[model samples]
Target: MLVTFDYFLKNLDLSNKNCLDVITQGQWLNVHPAALVFAAALAQKVGKENVIIDNTAGKSGLYIDRMGLYDWSKTESPYHYSRHEEAGRFVPVKQILTSNDQSKFITDLIPLLHLPPEKSQVIYYIMGELIRNVLEHSMSKDGAFVAAQYRPKSNVLSFGVCDTGVGLKKSLSYYHFPKDDVEALKLALMPGISGTSMSQSGTGDNAGAGLYIVKNLSKMTRNYFVIYSGTAMYKLLKYDKRIERPKIHSDPLDDRHSLVDKLPDFHGTLVGVDIALDDTSDFNALMEDIKVSYSKALRERKERRYKKVKFI
Candidate 1:
């Protein structure tokens, strides 16, 4: 189960001076995009030569190879498949270090999924915001590492973006002090709150709405959006499908979600999202809804500030 895997991830010891041993058990392996991107980010952090895939262990070894983990690490995959045969299925692991590279990835991503413009719009929005965040704020020389898979049977797309750089608490510390990792995540998700600025509204260059928009998009679509950095992780759980109209909260904690602190520390940030294509709405319409929610959240936040203010 993914929850068990999450617990297992907490036990990973990332301090080895020589090598990283990715040990797996059982006959089958269900590798999540989050795990794949994290491993790739770690490989870059520790140097590819110092990494080892101890035992891929089953038929699923081929799946991992196809997803391009082996290509990112020192391991040479034993299984092989024709590149021409993989069209519109998945994107191999890709590293982006610049704005140009980020733009190019977004351009090349749509055709790989073979999704219509309407269906692929959210993906473009998500990737653009995520990669831009890494390039602008992560302070990672290696930039962002991304990978995704389109599951045809379930009509779902899963993707992960990772960066090995200053984590949330440290990044936000430039302008706002978050006492811990989880609190940093909370501020990161709050609309108009930015690490780059202390104002109620962010600076001209950044509105700080990227993460907030992405999280609400996932909720409005009834899917999951997860953020992990340092020793904390915040997951926006799936909304109840029975609810005809789900509320989008500016405060991430108000939504149906899960959070964990005190996990093994990851130096950078990791984000994983699952999108159900069947539930996706028109891109423009969705953005409009988010705009309304964002404005309201900011207004309410300002109102609260005055309520607590002491008149001289």
Candidate 2:
């Protein structure tokens, strides 16, 4: 199930100390989901919350040859186009990361969003997994997406991930099931569903584990998590395990009706996760980490280059 950015954030109770602190002030960021789980565990440990405002568009077909690398974002739109609107602010950063260095590119940006030890770790995993998939399978070196990190004065967090890829259409066009936006999305979200028919080797995914794990985590952690692929968007609401009885399956989310909506018959994918941090002050520290990490990495490279220069 996927959700929009605002709907995801609206469910949080931002008054808690931990939730308030994470979004307090002077913090902004953009990140992916693997890291999100890490963030959630800590937020859970600290009893904080977060939010997300996703606005990622379709796939970027990055092809490299004699012409060097092409920026997929610079190309024309798909043969058929579909655009959906969601909410929130836009923070300035690279809207696209498609290179041998994209994983590091994501690593460089992860710290900018203020997340505690656990949230940070979860996001690290989410971002790593997504970027790894993109690099290995998306067949494109460059794709585009945008997100804004909002740390409320309370220190809560909200971020989004947007991308234009093969989406569900291309992912499952060869299958025997429906192929339009709605059906495609519905099928894709199903656990263990993979667009590809012929399979071989490696990771145990293709069964909706990635999406399901994150969604379940969202409920368990009381954070906002949404996914929009083509026209089907599933939003897992922020649940209060403390107040609300524990839920084990997808049948009881507040937004379950959304799952039944006719798929959007669109293309591409956008995912967003948001949580409330207890302190906003750490937001600054988080950004500092991004800068320091990048600077230190750059310095290391410069040193390496300098040594080679001397040897040469």
Candidate 3:
């Protein structure tokens, strides 16, 4: 059995399907961070008893147990779990954020991820921005689901936020409409693209900078960043050298900066970031550089548009 969005959608008969068995001993399963969120959502909907995990050896098993995906009711006190210096360990799954208490959530997560003050601040900003996006835009009545894992040996931290609402294509169609899923994914990463008209002319509560800032941070840190929604997946992989103005595509076709198409057609959006821990780099400086670069680009674009206008 393969555990993927396609697998779940194809198998509508939850009664006959043993979801846990597939999770524990499946022949193949996508180990993407968001995949766990999808699994947890599935378990909750299909009844946890229908899914039974007899094994907990690999990353898949570890994630399933850590997130309380099998039986959320059995989750231990404090509702947050962490294993220090261990790869694949994460803060407990945050199933819903009914209130505006993101600060507390980030404060609690910092120590568990073992991030220094500087890096912690960056992560805090990223999390806060993304969570705000979910609350304001996802349109999912179920709210957002979030999880993060740190791999000490690899010096990588991965986190993802998911929702089961209208996908990016539909969301952004309200402004700067995209032709398809791939185009929607690309537009979302642009500095000024947003679902809200209030974001127009950079005068609203949102400047459409969340994903833009996140992508730049990923590039500067030489990390991995990806957004999967509808039938497309856009990604940026960490490399030794710096990359400026990474490409966005309808189909990147196995490139390092990939834009893949024809995915399982997720109803909502999943944004994941994998940051490489580097104590030597100055986090504040990197952020400043991103801001300056973005400002320059925006100004240049405005000048070009101004020049093109026929001011009769």
Candidate 4:
């Protein structure tokens, strides 16, 4: 059976079944990233040995080989380089990272990817913040899973982070209640929505700026930024040209930007980013732009609140 969202939901209750068959012999199983995350989490929950691939001699085998799916030797790294080899280019790898081992993982990845110092810093910041989010908010005992691939010819870098934990809706519900998954995702991306409650002194994730900053950076680089949690999915496509700030569209029908609802629900959250290696965006300037935009948004929200109060 193909490992799709439906398959995941169906197999979630792994009770009497000893081995959950993911793929048949010689059949190519197309697995979505979110499905991969779900499978990994399930495997950890049940015995990894209990998840079986019926046929291991075809495309499915090669896929497993490329991803190091079943390899669990402590001496072997969870990261797997792509089987397709290109001369003088880095082999894209899917790596599993834990909060405890992130530093070493980043250190090993930096040199292999051959990223410029500035670009490396950007990746570091993005990955660090996302991993931190998983550690702090995900509540997943198994930690986070990440995958990255860079096509040198196209100069496109694609990476994703996934965690099977309390999804965005549940996490944000601890702060402000959301009517649905879509609203919860929107609120999570806002500048000051966080599960972390304020202290007596009123200092906390006052900026709640992690996702906000990541979104701005993606826009500045004219890259793709996608987030999926629960049944909602949000995507920001790369713009044709640079803009001071990109508009966020909440309508799912918007082709340029997508905010979709009613997707098959995943157990946790997944964030995917795609950037061009030749992107010339200045990191500091992008950060400043985010701050300005956020400040403007805060002012507008306060003004609306004040106007409502006056009308009442």
Candidate 2: Cα lDDT at 248: 39
Root-mean-square deviation per candidate: 2.1, 20.4, 5.8, 5.7
Instruction: Give the lowest summed-lDDT range of ten residues in model 1.
Output: 1-10
lDDT per residue, candidate 1, 128-180, as tens digits? 99889999889999999998888889888888899999988899998889999
**TM-score winner:** 1
Give the Cα lDDT of each candidate: 0.83, 0.42, 0.65, 0.60
Error of 4 at 39 (Å): 4.2
**How does model 2 score by TM-score?**
0.50
- Residue-level error in angstroms, candidate 3, position 5: 12
Deviation of model 3 at 36, angstroms: 1.6
Better of 3 and 4 by TM-score: 3
Lowest summed lDDT window (length 10), candidate 2: 61-70
Query: Alpha carbon lDDT of residue 84, candidate 1?
Result: 72
Local accuracy of candidate 4 as per-residue lDDT tens digits, 1-312: 111333334334434434445543355454434445445554554566666644444655555445444542112233345554422333223444465677766665556677667778677777777767877788887787765555678676666677778998888776578889888778777665666752211145444667767766776677777777888777776677745455542222332556767776666887776666576346676666666777676666567667443554
Kindly list the per-residue Cα lDDT of model 3 for residues 1-312, writing each as its tens digit. Answer: 111334433443334433434433454445555566665554554455655545534655655555555454223223235644432357656766564566677777787766666667777877888878887788887667777777778777777777777888998897778999998887778777678863434445767778888877776676777787888877776555545434332122332676667766667887778776673157777777776767775776567678565789
Candidate 4 at residue 289, lDDT? Answer: 66
Instruction: Please write out the lDDT profile of model 2 over residues 137-220, one tens digit for every residue.
Output: 333333544333545463444544445456655666765266465565555444344454433111365433344444444444
Q: Which regions of candidate 1 are displaced past 4 Å?
A: 1-5, 307-312
Q: What is the lDDT of residue 186 in candidate 4?
A: 80
